[model samples]
Target: MSEVASEVIREMKREFKVVGKSVPRRDGIGHVTGKTVYVDDISFPGMLHLKMVRSPIHHGIIRNVDFSEAEKVPGFVRVLTHRDVPKNIYTILCLIGVGPDEEPVLAVDRVLYKGEPIAAIVAETEEAAMEAVSRVKLDLEELPAVFDVEEALKPDAPILKPWGTNYFIYEGHHCRRVRFGDVEKGFAQADYIIEEVYNTSPIEHAPTETTACVAKPEPDGRYTVYTNTQALFFTMDNTALILQVPFSKLHFVGGTVGGGFGGKVDVITEPIATLAAMKTGRPVKFKYTREEEMRVSSTRSAWRMYFKDGVMKDGRIIARKVISYADSGAYNRHTPYAVTKHAANIAGPYTIPNVYIDAYCVYTNRQPASAMRGFGVTPASFAVECQMDKIAETIGMDPWEIRFINAYRNGDMRPHQKVVEDATLIEVMKAAAELVGHKLPEHLLKMHSWDREKA
Candidate 1:
């Protein structure tokens, strides 16, 4: 280990006793013993089951929510249509201090994505509630759906959320752009220029447990919910707003999460469960199957990035420019922040003197994306790292040597003009190379051997 890293480690060890030790988890015993009181395991007296009636169309205008036929179903207690929901439009992410761009509670007047909730059914029996949903027909007028980000960006594309010029919630130019030194001049001084485009697709966390929420209405016209949520406090606040009740009336208890790699952060099943309970005046439990969870819940946004790099004959990186476009499916859940972060991280750890990057979040008719593991860094890393390899090839230099010459160090200024603090990229690179016993290519090695003999 480096002296600095060792010192930091020593300091951390001094500050904390269990820092290096593998201490047993607090919930480990119950988890292994099967004694943990998970929400799905909890059953309440007179608790009713709930089921949602989701939109089958990708994009459509909700002409009507007819729940009259469902009221005749045996064991059916209460039904909640879009009209029954509050006017306040909010998302689970916004409620928890993520970002704005929430949709109307329940698909009000319009459904932007397939599997979006249009109405919910509540009943005495779980089977009855499931059957009751089929009776609650949603009359929807299909609108032109945008399945692709490129298509959505087209001038003639039907705007999903018409607030901005396009369907997306544009965070203005400041969020879309990044600049450093004069990129044009840097490229002009370069001996070689290379560019490549990288594509990434949406992926789900796919936790073993699907989304589930149980809500019980209190006598004081409030509801308490137990569900799988990463941000409990945020869910409570948003649920209260959606229910049109005081904050005190809504209580949230995050269950022992089976798993949520940023997927459970959104308020997917909670609002539906709360709505069902409130309407029925009885406790309601809603559990989503794997298929339903994947269909309706958000996932990581897909990214397409084009990287252009200018390199000197000696393999020194001079400039870099990246243009990234993110497919923010359906609602503007957290695309602005996602796109901004993607743009900021385009230059990676390379020490390019000039850099320019643009990231766009275009709306599409699919599940809205939220934060995922690694956030926007993975795509940016892949593009820049691959480009770095290409630059090495053109200059006939060792890839490691090229990286060592251009990799940013602590206190180095990045393309965004942000000074990096305590960066260990060089140390990490060398250590990794040494550990792997990296060797030069055959051609380079042969050339070097010939040069040595000549010398």
Candidate 2:
């Protein structure tokens, strides 16, 4: 190994005590022994089970919702509709200044997508809740639904939002945009222009323990919510806002999660369950069935990315213009923020002189998309790496050489204008090549992240 490589290893070892070492997982034993208590495992005495009555049609105006049959069901306690929610309109990102409260706690007036919750049926038993939910009568006027991201943007497209646009407005712009240098000039100077479109489907988190919460009304008029939410504080605050109560009136108990994978971050169950508990003066437990978990929960947004790259014969990428559309589905969950992150990263780690990105968080008549593992950046990385391979094929150069030529070094400016610091892509790539038995030439091997002169 070179001296620099040895020094890097020494530095890593010095900075990270756990690096290259195995430590026993703190929760491993409890998990294996079935001693771990998930939110669904806990129940309160005289607790009411909550089941959602959802929309069957993808797009529709709810002409009427009759819960008389549901109320007639044995063990049915009460049905909570949008009217019952103190402040029904809520957006999970409201805490971060991201919305005008787009999502309804229980959908009002109309249902935007199939499986959108219209009413919460609380009953003495889970079976009773399910039966009551099934018995609720809905009269809906079906509307033409647009599922494609591009189709939703057309002038004739069914406008999903009240502001009269299918896409999120970014400070008066139609999309989140980033411009570094003059992309047109770079393309004019290039030998080749490689253009391709990439598409991705929404992915469900499908955690072993589905989205669940148990809300109990305290004797002191406060509410205690036991949930599997990954964002405990966020859920509490949002729930308080939805309930129109002081933040101090809510106590969120969490920390044990079967699996989140970014799905549990959305404030879905806590507010409504707590409201149900408050109205009935009894604890309310809301849990998604396996099918409900798969069908109704928020997912990683589907993406359509168009990449047009200006490349040199020697394999340096001079400019990249990326137009990306993220299907945020019926509501804005975390996708508005995700699109901003996507705009910053869609160009990847390469240091192109000129880069342009326009990322849109679009509304469609599908289930709302939210956070998953690396919601904004993972899809971009996939597209970028694939585009890199395409560029290598077009220029007749080694993929490794192409990457090393364009890899951003420390002190480089990202397209978002953030100063790159502590970048390790080049070094990590070198080590990865060796581990995979791919022999890189000396020129590529000598490249380091710290100094551009070495390249």
Candidate 3:
């Protein structure tokens, strides 16, 4: 361990018993011994399996749906369509007062993306449910679809949202906007202008265990839900609102999730399964098959970022302008919030006098994108670091020297108007150089995060 870190740990150990001590994990034994209980491990008597009939095309108007053959299946219990849902339209962030409730519990009239659920089939067995779902027929009229973020924003782009725009509306603005100083003046005064575009594809979580839930109707006039959801109260509350039932009537049980990585936070599979149990007075299990988990479940949104930086010959950045677009796919699951975060972070950690950023949460004919590990910030960091490297190369300066010169200090102000209080970029970089066996120049070695005047 580094001397500084070791000293800090020793100081903390004097005040706290657990600090600097090895601790045993409470759940490690259960996990290693295979005794840990997961949502799919629990089953009840008279349980029914639920499967969905999804849209085959990316964008289409539903012409007709025929379930006659599906009803003939031997163990077919019943089917739930949009009509069966108590409240059809929902936005996952509605609890936080975010939205126009753009997503449907079950798609009606049209399907915006492939794998969008149109109907759900319940049967005595999983195989029977799968068969019934396959037997159901759908007549859809295909429509033009847009996948590219830039293409979706063009004037000639096919409209996707009901609000007649391909992007999420942020407070009367088309995109989240951040401005601090005069970027044009700074750019004109700079010696060189560096511009680059960075693009990232959508990424799937693909947890070891797929999303699953079991809702059972209790004899005491309440419902019990066994779920793998990362958010228990959030899911229960949203499920209650979707089912139009009192919150007191639902009990959500969640623990031992195989893996989430921000994937299982969305409130899917619980409400519909609970409703099925309510209608039939029996337990209903809704589990996403591997195919459904991979193809239909929410993934990290794809991002396209355009970065333009103005720098002097001495390795100091004077201005930065970033235009970022996040492809939120068909619905507003969690991408709106993610875009807001992206807008705040795309400026990066460096302190520039003039900064301007516009980040848009765009919609396209693809599977809806939601959260992943560092959903919004990770992409921005990737683009920002790459842009930093490009700037260093163009200015004929060492990358570390450039970073050390522009690194934000403790009292620096960010583009978002927040004062940086505890920044340690210089110190951390120095420690990293030491650990990696790289010798920084004397001037760079003397730089500290507390005071930038030394640099």
lDDT-superior candidate, 1 or 2: 2
Q: Write the per-residue lDDT of candidate 1 for residues 14-83, one digit (tens) a residue.
A: 7886878788899999999999877788678999987788889999998887788888989998877667
Best by lDDT: 2
TM-score, per-candidate, Cα-based = 0.89, 0.97, 0.97
| Candidate 2 global TM-score | 0.97
Badly placed stretches (over 4 Å) of model 1 are 2-16, 91-102, 167-171, 219-222, 439-455
Question: Considering lDDT, which of the candidate structures 2 and 3 is the better prediction for this target?
Answer: 2
Alpha-carbon runs more than 4 Å astray in model 2: 1-20
Worst 10 residues of 1 by lDDT: 446-455
Q: What range of 10 consecutive residues in model 3 has the weakest lDDT sum?
A: 446-455
Candidate 2 lDDT tens digits, 83-166: 999999988898999887789999899999999999999999999999998999999999999999999999999999988899
